[model samples]
Target: MNGAGCGSCHSAPGVWPEGEVGPSLDSFAQQTLIAGRLPNRADILADYVRNAPKYVPQSGMPAMPLTEEEARDVAAYLYTLGRR
Candidate 1:
């Protein structure tokens, strides 16, 4: 999650200071779709977060500059949200 700056746009219950730009990501794991377009599975999420416009044409999220490995790591972390 380092250097991805996800906290700059999204807010979670205990992740960081609340972000004012985008929607809260607190219940990301339980979400059914990514950016309201693609499936919420890990592989799709990793790719979507890495390149948002590729999946959601109207997404406000810019493409994240994460590597393949880093995107997977971010996906893994997102899956742990709202479970505890």
Candidate 2:
């Protein structure tokens, strides 16, 4: 789910150019917050990923509408991306 969707824009080896569209998740685990406001907790980020549209109507990000389980899985995957 998230792998297919987000991976389209964020694969490895320069697939996703670093810029304003969205920050790379490679270092997301180290970040203190998402979008510079929301805390960078796994659950919070998962919720945001599941329902980005509700929080920011004008955001270009599309809503994924993931189930709680899916969100948790994806968030777990993301958290593993840049772990030290």
Candidate 3:
């Protein structure tokens, strides 16, 4: 997701320079809510990863140019953040 600039705004365990533009995704697996509103499930997380604006129109995050599978993959990866 480097090409999508996810690391620029989010920081996992090993990633660095987690930008302040968005919240750090360090403990994503343990998060009870996604974006502070939606349920923290894989499907919801995938949708949020692809089009956060759809869930929250006022969200600062824009729609990501990723396919459904790509978004799902990203969501799955995010879910593994705090697992280790």
Candidate 4:
């Protein structure tokens, strides 16, 4: 998947180049919420990955073209980041 594009808006330990548009994802796995609103879970993350605007209409994230499976895969990968 092209989750690398996400690095342009959110910073993660291995994803580059770091961005300032969104919050850093270095500790995403430890977060209690997604976008500070929805519960931080696989399903929610996958949905957000597919279409963030659906959950947060005002979200700056644009809808992605990834398939459901691809979005879920990206979410799973994101959950591996910043594991203590």
Model 4 agreement with the true structure over 1-84: per-residue lDDT tens digits = 335387778777767778879888777899999988999989889989889999999989878888888898888888888878
Q: Single out the weakest 10-residue window by summed lDDT for candidate 3.
A: 11-20
Best by lDDT: 3
Q: Mind sharing the TM-score for model 4?
A: 0.88
Candidate 3, lDDT over the whole model: 0.84
RMSD of 2: 3.3
Write one digit per residue (lDDT tens) for candidate 1, span 1-84: 535677778887665656668777888888998877688998898998889887777768889999999999989988988865
Which prediction has more favorable lDDT, 1 or 4? Answer: 4
How does each model score on lDDT? Answer: 0.81, 0.69, 0.84, 0.83
Per-residue lDDT tens digits for candidate 2, residues 1-84, read 434366554443333443345556676667787767788888788888888776677766677867889888877877776678
Assess the local accuracy of residue 30 in candidate 3 as a C-alpha lDDT between 0 and 100.
Answer: 88
Q: Please say which candidate is ahead in lDDT: 3 or 4.
A: 3
Sorted on lDDT, best first, the list reads: 3, 4, 1, 2
Clashes of each: 0, 0, 0, 0
Q: lDDT tens digits, residues 1-84, model 3?
A: 655778778766666656668888887898899989999999889888889999999987889999999998899889888875
- Candidate 4: pairs in clash: none
Q: How close is each model in CA RMSD to the real structure?
A: 1.7, 3.3, 1.5, 1.6
Error of 3 at 70 (Å): 0.7
